[model samples]
Target chain A: MGFAIDKIRADFPILLRQVHNKPLIYFDNAATSQKPQQVIDALVHYYTYQNANIHRGVHALSQEATDAYERARDLVKTFFNARLREEIIFTAGTTHSINLVAHGFRSWLQPKDEIIVGQAEHHSNIVPWQMACALTGAVLKVLPIDENGQLQLETLKSLLGPQTKLVVVNHVSNALGTINPIETIIEMAHGHGVQVLVDGAQASSHISVDVQALDVDYYITSAHKMCGPTGVGMLYGKKELLEALPPYQGGGEMIKEVYFEGTTYAGLPHKFEAGTPNIAGGIGFGAAIEYLNTIGLEEIAAYEHELLMHATQGLKQIEGLKIYGDITHKTAVVSFNIGQLHPYDVGTLLDRMGIAVRTGQHCTQPVMDFYGIPGTVRASFAFYNTKEEIDIMIKGVQRAVNMLQ
Target chain B: MIIEAQQEIIEEFALFDDWMDKYEHLIGLGKTLPLIDPQFKTDQYIIKGCQSKVWLRAEQQDGRVYFWADSDAIITKGIVSVLIRAFSGLSAQDIVNAPTDFIKEIGLNDHLSPTRANGLVSMIKQMKLYATAFAAQNNA
Candidate 1:
């Protein structure tokens, strides 16, 4: 069956918004996806009726809230096909999730131990490991990408050794939209007895993530990128690995017993969830997952792949436009530059035309350094986005190019 | 004259009916800006908090401050151009005391994205800091 594009578009209210007296064609989905009305309603319902603290209170409202919150965790666990419900840890966002893992590994790591990270990783994935290495006296190494923007797998294999403790890489590149071969990478890392963390911040929204099938040590993603509320995300780790790692934060929910002496930490998920959580966000994330499931991730992926092909063709028609990243394995993201024109100029001009595209280093300065450019004008798409929108974007880019050049 | 320069910018922007035309004008202005020397592109002269790398160089000659600036991004360079035109070749005290409300009056602030607006503020702050430094040197 074909994907219902129009029906899905209607689900997001922001699609109806107009920018600069023109219809809003949001192509900045890589930064954050527009929340569907279902997710929005979930948030409102929580604040309106189910607004109460969870896990601690014995009242009816608290029980109701706790039930709803726990249900959201179950939804997330199922969405990622995690082994155990306790393995899913609610976090502030992708950065927070990665930092939590990195923090836990600080004590586990030893001097001269090595960590491998991809050059295409977002700063969030790279910086935390650098800090972890600095603190633990571990060495940090990088897996470089080829000219086609694919990770140098042979180089990665060469880097892995007895000293290699962990391999960190993103499932998709936010800057270049390169869909990494993480399954292969994970399998290879496991052979070397090295733990692998996949930053699924960009992938979880567009692709199905089965942590069990992938057998990755840790998988992390932000809810905002998946049409959920901001300020919330999830981290899925192997049950044993999570249990072995030290607690990331010391606080009320993350504790089992407290005294002047050293306190016992809470088990599994709660050991990392420190304070009052984003109750509404968690519920909204569950609603987002429900929404995605209704449409289906596989179908969304197919439709978006079609959209990406259309955009690539449309954008290629423009003279002097050069696109970064390999098209064969990519999401619905097109990062490009025209002639000698700066991306900010193109992005600013496009904004005037009511097309919202991202223009910057995209939090991946190393990728930018690799490309030897300041940044590119990025037009990323969600499933709700249309070929018609891509047409408008192409026309807008053409107009901007003419004006700037 | 600085106020008059700002007034001229406002009048120029008013001639354009749409943002596209206004941005074209800004880009044109950017192309004609007195660019800073490559030596001054060092981190010491760069303004932090700008999404684009902005380099500003100031020279005080005969009790007046002359400013030259550049940015990697065209729009940011345009913004730097507007700032330089308003404050350059003015006395240190005059440049420091110049009103920034002219930027809003020209509708530039409304046209700018939040990050660009922050960059505008950073550029203005750096210019004033340069003016202040030059003023202190004169006093010494």
Candidate 2:
């Protein structure tokens, strides 16, 4: 891989711009990755040339539209190494994908069914399952994380038993950037006859996912997190499992036949995709995946890992700063707070220098509760980010701390 | 400002939607937020829970309550803007009795995310507590 940082930076138009009279140093990749020119072009191409309703049209435009949509699905199928294209269902995003499974996976969910989740899982993953368990009268069990913010795998294993029907785990902790041992998680759960659903929202862009290799029953991810358009994502389930689960929503295109007597639903993926979806979004998503593949995920991940390590070391030199989520073997997210200065204050000063970072709980309130703090100033990275950007971020935080002190 | 003008401003609080839209002008109505006085950054007034540097000042005028908040962060300033809109010119009783649902109705929380919503709630609570004290003094 070239690791051509300049070329990669050039591909993103927004990175070239300035904020606050300073060149933009976007460190908010964990919030959403910037789109490459190719992805944006693909979006333009879809809306410009091949715009039409998908799946059921007999016209030429319809066939073209259907091909583009199916092609995106096939790309995702290969991207994740899903067993079949039919097992992949398009969703609005990771939140919707997880909610679908949480609500529709009621088939095997009995009263008192035990569900296991990690304390570090994003609220999107935790809240839905919590609500589901509350509604179903099932038990919501948590797999606690150690001080370093890594999941306690042994504890997770001990928590799972015969009563455990579904296990929800994040492929990567969005807040702490901990790469979970999902393969072990899946194997252990399956041995106890439990299904695992992995939240791949934060992991999909940074790591290569093979649903077959991991043997997870369900996997969900957001396209926006990976440089694709928002409001588009995919849910991958084992063919049998997807077939067994009921449709999450009912509307046009998810039916083979509908009568007052009864309704016969469409098979597999379409059964879940009711109504007109983000056709342009699906095309743009494929484009984003293609863009990521060309750069190579391993190369990006390796470079970002190096960046995080370097930034952590550099940031340590600054005084009165407490870095949150300082776990080894983490991804590119660095969260911290300066002594006596709020993370919001820290963030505001950083923003004035055209350094964009996410501040606050990052939607993982449990992690905040665990740390006994309300929030942190989170600087997340991506392939396009550089060492220089991290330097600027560090300087900004230091200045804020100094002025406040 | 003139007493009649202040009275008109106080009357506008009863019509919340109008107050919300015109909050920025009202904040400009004060002594321009004092350049945020960098000396106030000590540990004493530091809000432990917030991600931004939110400094709050509550004032009383003719039995009514007002708040002036400034944040170093932009979105947090926008949040403070909304808080001032919701709470300024109202009495302590009205401030306490006012529902959080008004925030949802304006779709203020839409531009903000869930985590930001939590911070905004905290900010609003702090403001209401100050209002409660003012209301208590007036009642006494």
Candidate 3:
């Protein structure tokens, strides 16, 4: 179906609102996309009608809730093209998902073993592996990126040594919007007899992911970034790998049988998910995937690319403006800074004009350290954003530069 | 205690019809702020905020305390300049006793409020810290 931008914009209620007496121009989709009416209604309906504990109770309410939650898991598995239903594990979000895998590897890794991560990863990805390495006495390695923000794949070749157990990298760089070649990264890492865990938090919203096609050992994404509710996301791990790893948490549902001396753990997903999960958020996440299906990812990607080009061309016109990342292969995010002006100043001015953008290091301090700058003003676009909005932002940047100068 | 200096800021901001002029005036104020000595610009005097870096220095001249500061972000520098204008050249005790209500009254509550993590609030806290240190020295 063709993209109906006008009608699609109406689906988001917040798009109609105003900020600072000006119409809201939301350009912070990378942080979190504005929820659609369908997603909001899904949450409300779940709480109003299907509110009950799952997997334990036998009443009609309990059965209905259990079916809804399981149906959500099925939807997630199909969305990411995971092979088995039990392979999809629900967690708080991407960070929680990563920590689960990191914690699981504590016993699997030995001293002097290695975990290699991309230089462009957000702190969430880097810190977890660091903690895991600290615990297991394994060394953490960095696969450095080029000046243009592309990962140096040759360095990856060298980094994957006999000691390397796993390679961790993001499908997309959140700070600079560099779409790392994960398919190639996965293939290269596997050739060296190592497992690869891909952080798909940034890619799941922009592109359709197929874990089977990529042959990725593990993949994870947060729901909030893709027009779904916060506090819930899906982690897709191979069934055998998940069964091999010990449980990240222990509670009521995750246990097979309990005894004073010994307790047996449950299988696959429940093994990782302990206690009650975000039921409503899980169902809402299903609704969000359905919503994206209606729009079609191909259409969204094409339109967003057009907007990114429009923004890049307009921003490049300004003197002394430097944009980070490889824009040609990246998602629709423009992170730039004007000469002699701090990103905070520009971002604050844009907010006053009713534009929402993210400033600061954006939780990627290593990338900032690489660029030798404080931070860049990041403006990310979604399918709901329009060309008119990009023009307004371009004008906003020019005005901010004039004022700061 | 330093309401006179703060009132002047409020009156000056009231002349502007829009936030643009107010910000332009703020930039002018930042330019007018007395620069801190180059030696004090290191991390020793640095108050690192999430968004920007601030270098603040305080010294007791006779019976009164004086403050000098700078920030990489010009808008933040302007906010700090106004704060310094209100608190500097007062006795250590008076500086300690001075209320920061003038900041909100000057129409900078949203961006540079004391509660914000923009380093301006930390700057205010650092100012009071210097006052307390000097007050302790006087007692000693």
TM-scores for candidates 1 onward, in order = 0.97, 0.81, 0.98
Best by DockQ: 3
Instruction: Output the number of the TM-score-best candidate.
Output: 3
- In terms of lDDT, the poorest run of 10 residues in model 3 chain B is B111-120
Model 2 agreement with the true structure over B1-140: per-residue lDDT tens digits: 22333345445544555332333333333224433355755565444455656777778898677776666554466556656765677777888776665554444443345455327767777887888888888889
DockQ of 2: 0.19
Ranking by DockQ: 3, 1, 2
**Candidate 1 deviant stretches above 4 angstroms:** B111-114
Candidate 3 chain A, run of 10 with poorest lDDT: A325-334
A1-405, model 2: which lDDT tens digit per residue? 457999998999999899867899999889999999999999999889999998888999989988998999999999999879999999999999999998886655778988998899999998888788878888899999888888888997789898998889899888878888899989988888889999999999998988898889999999999999999999999999889898889999899999999999999889999999999999999999899888888998899988999899988898767777687777898888766566765675677678998877899989989988768888889999999889888887776665444
**Listing candidates in order, what is each one's chain A TM-score?**
0.99, 0.98, 0.99
Per-residue error for A103 in candidate 2, Å, reads 0.9
Query: lDDT (0-100) at residue B136 of candidate 1?
Result: 88
For candidate 3, the per-residue lDDT at A327 reads 55
Q: Is candidate 1 or candidate 3 better by DockQ?
A: 3
Error of 1 at B99 (Å): 0.4
Q: Model 2: how far is A256 from its true place, Å?
A: 0.9
Scored against the true structure, residue A357 in model 3 reaches a CA lDDT of 97
